[model samples]
Target: MSDWEDEAEEPSAGKQRPRAPASTPWMPPQSHKQRSYREEGGDQPPTRERAWEPRGQREGDRGGFRRPEERSWSSRELPRQPETVTGGGWSRDFRRQEANRELASAPLCFRLDSSVVGTVIGRGGSKIRELEESSGSRIKITKGDYDSEVKIFGSSEQQDKAKTMIDDLLERYDERPETDTRFGYKEIRPSRSADMSTTVTAPVKRGINWASLRENREKYEIMKWADLPPMEKNFYKEASNIASMSQDEVTRWRKDNNNIICDDLKEGQKRPIPNPIRNFRDAFDHFPEIMSTIKKVGFDRPTPIQSQAWPIVLQGIDLIGIAQTGTGKTLAYLLPGFIHLDLQPLPKNERLGPGMLVLAPTRELALQVKAECSKYTYKGFKSICIYGGGDRKGQINVVTKGVDIVIATPGRLNDLQMNNFINLKSITYLVLDEADRMLDMGFEPQIMKILIDIRPDRQTIMTSATWPDGVRRLAKSYLKDPLMVYVGTLDLAAVNTVEQRVFIIPEEEKRAFTLHFIDSLKPKDKVLIFVGKKIIVDDLASDFSLQGIAVQSLHGNREQCDREQALDDFKKGIVRILVATDLASRGLDVHDITHVFNFDFPRNIEEYVHRIGRTGRAGRTGESVTLVTRKDWKVASELISILERANQEVPEELFEMAERYKHFKIKKDSERDMIPRQGRWRDNP
Candidate 1:
């Protein structure tokens, strides 16, 4: 600063310092000139040059300066232009080209609320980067005070895909509440579109006789309980109270039999739930042929389910029977169905279709029910079993011909009904067997479609081993004031007759353990080995075959004939060991199965119960050995609870494994919570 002041105060040898005009406008000082002069040589001073001097005065009149107004406006000639160019034409053309370029390169823009920006961006912009990579777009979020504009630079397709992804993400986020355990905070707000309602109306189908259908339904309802003959009414009343017990006696009886009854009726409207039949004569004293069939099968009084279900079903009431597999559920429904079919108000000739319709979840179950119908012959009635993977033409042939009973899987039955090959209007007795399994297989839509054609006044009987929410919903939707007869607690429990044992082992050791178990089996011992995957069923079956063990494999991938043959062989003891997937978990009835080996634990606890139930049947004690690994820790706690409820020993390792998994899950959730997340969006993007 001292040197600069010295230089400014004193002039150089041949130069004089010029003073700034008092009225001159302030101009920004150029330090670059000083820097250049100093860079050249600090000893010499910089030259003072006036940049605003007119061109005419610059060279010819350097001694004096002229004012800007004195100079002529048109004194300087403009640069030459081409012949085709006009005033500002080139400028206009340049601007037009620039505008077109900008239009072509413009990015896609959208707006989102400020709060949800962090959620979209994720921790450290991970979610945005993922979107960009997946969509082949460059996303830039320019945040404002209240909102943000998302600019996506990509082709039209990429931009559209990115937008769809973001929309889907936000939609999913809005559907489930967000919770942070660390702060004990939860976002319980409703979605932005929660207030919006969408109403959809289904159009009526043409070419259907609405009036005739209504008339038929009215005629069917005319045969209700009040319309039954006096003699038949007396028989129902006697059968219901034949084994009557005191309130205390009834409670003790239910507890001893492990029966849980849930009748959906008000206290004033409730009727006394029937007690169990003491013997075959208690309920079927009037039906000698049924008594003969029961005697020929064996001297068995009646299973708890059959005992209680017969009276309620016989009284023309809807029944929901929940019992373990192999608890004579089929007989409970079949006998009532036979009686209902025989007692139809409309005679066989007057009826449009079969008198009874049995909906099974699987082909095997359908066939088994058909076999049961065959076993207990009632009035020489003809029955047909139809399912997918079977001969469709043959099924249609059987349906076209007169049949009294129709047992079918929902898919095939729906197909037949849709094609007008089967008529459900005349079905007076309906039975939905294995209702839980059917729902599990996603047959609800088909079941609904099939049920639509059946008369609403028909008697409905639904049987299931487990009472899941889906089955409950189905029952509520279809059944009218049904009485629930559960053999045990509604919670999933295996047959108490089966002894459950679990072994915690590595996945690789499963095959060895199975082989060892097979070696230990007695000559008469029949076992069913359950695996998780279809390929594993084949692999294990082939491995057992290589070991010279007669094993039959059953899975969904097999042909219908092959599956039937395998099940038949297993039942007849041709193959003592049956290896299968969960396909055989339900509806597989083999009375002689002495053991159930779970080579691989099932994916769910319900399947596990069904798998073990395959072994113990008809009061015969059996055993089940399951192999558990670390990967199955998700179901470990549930397995322990099932074991404890059944009074079976829970292994110490299972408890430890469940505890470790719980800790791991907690740590994972905590780490996931550490990620950045924003507040709810005011409006969707």
Candidate 2:
């Protein structure tokens, strides 16, 4: 009979059934003599088949072979025990137990709402599986009567990591809008009440509590009035009353100082706007060092912008100073900034970064602010200027060392901020100097990016030569309850100290007119020639250099070092003429700039005002001569308005050119209206 038939036979009452052949084909067929030897329990070499057999089964066991129905359910389902050696050696089961003990940790459990449980688990449980793999833990979800309990089993580190990931996932789901399929529409969920509480055993009854999260996660405390030290609070209180002028007194003071305007004051909600300070002593009475610095710098009295801006800023109010350039707007903000830095509750050592920040539009302006900062040092505070084309690594090094003030151009500051090279969390005072110029240069996006890192409650002071729509939008977005202080009328106008002259000449005669005007300048005159293009600046600068005139050029194409040198030479009177583009139109502060020659009309009238205001600084009389051609007719009306506002002569030729352009524009619009609409031309009878 075959071995299969023999194994299938039933055994007699007392006799055991014969064993079957090994199922694996790799085992050679055993001879009858070997089978008889194994059946008699004779010692023989162990085969691969015997090594894999279940423990406690002997070769002669009568019940080793049985039908499937005879096996118990538990015996079939349970895992086979690991084989144990008869000698004194560690078993596989012992090692597994030891590993389990080492990895054992208390399971972390959290409850999620039944509605959001699917979101956490994802389809096919892929998200939960991914979380388990990434966090090195085993996650199990058990649906209870009220909510689903998520339990994580792993080491303590793994459990914490899993918990954090789950919390983040829950937060994202909480932010999503709730949808109801039965209603077939999306509805806004009402905010949870403050008194509502979350139970440990129940689902998160409310959305993620952001206030609680912030309290647990914030690394630093935001500065506020209640957090101020006793001494700093007392100092601010005393300084608040230093203005000492009543509302009537303030009105009279503002009127006397060129009708200085203050707007957007919250009448009853806050303290009354402080009065204008006549002298440095009035505002800086508590800080003798500041007063001494002002005296040392020989500032007899504050300018119009500074006079009103001082009280508002020193009172810790956000300000939008709409003053023309060169009206001491820099000092107006800088002096108050120094006091603000000094009066902060946190000391310099405790601050994460600089306490004050000044954002300028150009490298030249940034350096100028730095120079001003150097002149008025307080309590050994240090300031750094960061801009493109400078030593970036050196700037980073200086910042790492420590700085109390940072004056930077927006581009380089944004670069540093994105790369995490600078921290703005500690900035309590910020100055957007030349804000309109910054917007004109297309730095608004970069400025917005840099401001994202700064604490929102920081006091901001924005100074613009002209308040254009872009600047207004930026101010509205960033400033809170800001007070406005403008030196002159809010409408665009040049400084009154400059004599404005306009000559209507052909575009071809502009260079000759500029040359003739240069010839008329006295030996003591310092002229700033403004052109529209970089090529013009270079071409005119080259022509003047050939004529043996002491001249330098300033434009964006020039290297930063060369630009700085040119500006320095111009400021020190080493060069009598500095031909530049509108780059120098704003924040080019040279007290001796006696002449501004506009060789080419600016793109807009606002730039024209800024170009002329560069001269006539610090109560000094200066002259600006503009050469307007046919190409500049569009802006003639604005030019006329600006000239009239400044009480300067409005040339008859300018008015005629403006009238001609107006008539031409009206005719063009009429012709455009008469044209048939697209796709409707055939319908026109």
Candidate 3:
């Protein structure tokens, strides 16, 4: 595992740069002979055929990464490699070398052979001094300092010219055969670039290329976790019970397990996983720090999504993991992501955009991911969580310094990028944390724009509870050879981890049933109550407070600080009941929560499933109780389907009500219409 690896000529395992010819300064008297950056001797025997891996950042950089396969290194035979021209990106084929005064400066180092080191730092360091002035960059002449490595530090253009100068200087002094490097340099290679057109593009539109995303999913590369090599596999090896299940047995198991059905999956040109891991340790064996962090977080095993996603991501493959909410989906990516970081640890003080970018849909989820990052964080690793409602200047200050990982919502990440306050050129890993929600909330334009900023060669990981047509289309555009993983049933079935109940009550008496249910909850247990609208969340929290219940409500409009505090209070057991709108539905992982109450049913099954997912996490048994009224009848059937999926008993009346409202649909009117047709749906009423 060398500290550095060469970049891709083809779209290799992950986005890494070609061992670019060091930018040159001298013209050869004759047209120059050339060679690959790694092939120093044209006729020399090839060094052991190397496993392709992620590129390492230069010393003092804070953004480096390596995957599992690339961690082997022989320190004795190595020289410090200069940073690649493209920063191991997938965005563009080559650097435009545009004089965008905004691109920050960094020190570049090239290790010189011991023999010619004296020639470059000639009499009294005069040659090195002269080279620096000509290139308009600072050149440090490290006299016998391996760490210094004849370093050139400054803006990108200056570094390019400086490298060229060094190459020429070396050529002039050494009569030895021209080795692995070229007497020539190539401009950056070609890759996808942002077109930057304002007009709507076909690929960015919803459901535009679903045919590709909807093809057979089973055709993807599938490998068993038990079958991997000693270095590649997890430490704990028990043959998977899943492997023994026949295709029919798998379907039967999924019927009760609340996992994605093979039938529901349509891999968007699946990047095959020859051997996907099924445990937490195998996917994260590269680094001890990550292993320590996982234990601190108390995650004993891999969730369904984690097991399948680990190997593909470990190999630097792009991924789209579609799993139900609260299945440790966050950790599935984060832990293995740690292994990737270990594979190519960033330099101590990197001064560019983060190598890893995680785009979450909501602010809460972003904060949650940030918290998880803290728990599993490595000592050299740095990250910033940015979203709206936070201090913009504060976030900007963090971005200017550079980071290893960025956890952000689409809008904020895009805005910072647009304002030129942040850079994405060097990013090697990109994650669409909740791809479905981002698209559903009309973030395609922002997401597409962010996609362009990243190197086109970066590894992309997208996760969602439901794989909608639009998200699939978005996946096809950004991800290349992504392994699509389904953890739970792709349908919006409630997680089988929680027990479910439906209580049919009249609209006016619904509050009584809710009160009765609340009274029945154990005194110490935490509960989450969901309402459809933001105002109702506030109203219910207020009413429940009067009823002597300790409750806090959350929604989109609250200040970021308030939402953070509320969630903290709930998780700390200060608040036993937290009421909220759909904002709290997707990813609120409070392990002690014992129940979920849908006071007002959601607009869709996806919302309902996510709402209840607030409870029943980390192997905790929990319950979901829905008070079904005539107003809820229309979509009541969705609840029945999910209940059936979880093998729960669906009350007969629920089916009757679903059919009754099957022909009924809500209508818009100038006057506020009430759910009960009496209590109007507004604050004034």
Candidate 4:
């Protein structure tokens, strides 16, 4: 089982490089004329009959005249050769030397298969180096528009020697069967190439591309824990299963199951996991001035996301953080900024622009970042929160004064940048918080435009609860050599402490069912309801108010001041029930939400996670109920797949309906809005 194997010859295999062009002349030079064939055979030997006459026939003086086949080294005696060599290296092939000289002047070229170029490079051109050394020729491998090839050139003798070595290399290279490599797998080859016609032989393998594998290794590593092959189906299935399991359940399962997996996919064998945190604590501790600033803010222990990410960021590597909401992403980037800032200080008067820019999806989330930043704002280090909806005059004033960090929403930040209220060119560190939400909200273009205004050499960091396509693409463009940190998959529902349940109800009884669900809530149980439309929000809020339940509505249609009031009241528990549309589903940071009621099922499963995420904050347990109508039964079942992946329990009734009508589509009138008509309800009242 040799690791080096030439791929089997097959019609599907890619074409190989052509043979090296033949050198025109193959003869010795005037300097070495004595060794030339012409010099040795200038005078022909005598005829065999005459030479073998009498004495030779009788005594073997005719040794040279023996049968051609009998001229064996073992049987023949040594000849008395001349002591001195022939004269002046007898007549050389001056023409051959002239041809070699001309050929060496021309560019030496040989084309190889593009596919095997990587294998030939062999970790910093080691394989290529070996080839050049063996062939006694200077080599240059180049990739261009048409394909890739290698070129060699040297003195006439050296080039000829190189040509022979290349032929042998290609012969050995072409013998092995083609095998694709998975990530980190290594193999060897007898020679650089197998095809004698071309020097393009290299062992290749079929598996994950290194870039893709490196980007998604955080996820793939988990799959390896299950001892599954590196397939998409395997990754998704295991990710879902792992996502659904509780921490305790996963722990117990690992102890009992023989095939339990970890992030790197090591089974039976423990993997060499790197230190989760770089010396961030040491960095903070060594810089007492910064430590004083951090300690004053109650920075005792690093959060899970912080523990994994800060060290990598401080190490100045890129990062892909994969933690859920409320995991303290602010500190993850903030700690690194502080460490970097403390180490490299700037003059006070010169701090007119932000050193770090943290972009959040919404004003509230941006404000939240600023608030978190405040805790660490000691010893002249400060951050300003900037977003629309508030007084711009004040925001401008704050920006004008200069701050160490600026936490902002994309649109507002752009507005300020356009107005010349802030200078983005000075930004050294960039952070995109809740990247999935920003992208989902259609802030990508503005985010990109803002990034374009800043320095390209800046350190960029992005945090997201979900790894959506938009976020992934943005990460590719913005970050360089990022260290990916994935705590869990995005669609894992009710993470930490929220019990997700669904109730199947008829469409006609939807409102009544919601009322019943709300009535069941105990006193002071803060509940958040997620609705699809703005009209439903108003109707639901009215319905709850009339029902003697303290509630308020928050949606995009409302005036900015009014929306703020509603959110503020909800946060204060002044209104225990806050009915909101999708706007609040993402960056609304009210931690006291005890229950989240999906008065209507979300349009998609990802929305479902965001809705439920509002509750279950700060280690407090929360509960969520999805009021599913007959029309939603099918979608509910599809939704259960996500829940099951998150390891949440699905209601049996919902599952049963899905099982019965798996192929069925729920029919509904286009006009059947979740928000009931106001006239009839008001007239009845």
Ranking by lDDT: 2, 1, 3, 4
- Tens digits of lDDT, candidate 2, 152-237: 66676787798778667765756655332111111122122211122133232445799988985554544333443322312333
Show how many residue pairs clash in every candidate, following the order shown: 0, 0, 36, 34
Could you tell me how far off, in angstroms, the CA of residue 169 lies in candidate 1 after the best superposition?
A: 50
TM-score each candidate. 0.65, 0.67, 0.58, 0.55
lDDT of all predictions: 0.75, 0.76, 0.66, 0.63
Which structure among the candidates has the greatest TM-score?
Answer: 2
Write candidate 1's Cα lDDT for 397-444 as tens digits. 988988999999998888999999988877778899988777777888
Candidate 2, residue 362: the lDDT equals 79
Among residues 3 or more apart in sequence or in different chains, the pairs in candidate 1 whose N, CA or C atoms overlap within 3 Å are: none
Q: Pick the winner on lDDT between candidates 2 and 3.
A: 2
TM-score of 4: 0.55
Query: In candidate 1, which residue ranges exceed 4 Å CA deviation?
Result: 1-235, 239-244, 265-271, 672-675, 679-685
Tens-digit lDDT track of model 3 for 637-667: 7778888888999999998887766645423
Cα shift from native, residue 417, model 1 (Å): 0.9
What global local distance difference test value does model 2 have? 0.76
| Candidate 4 lDDT | 0.63
Native-to-model Cα distance after best TM-score fit, residue 213 in candidate 4, in Å? 33
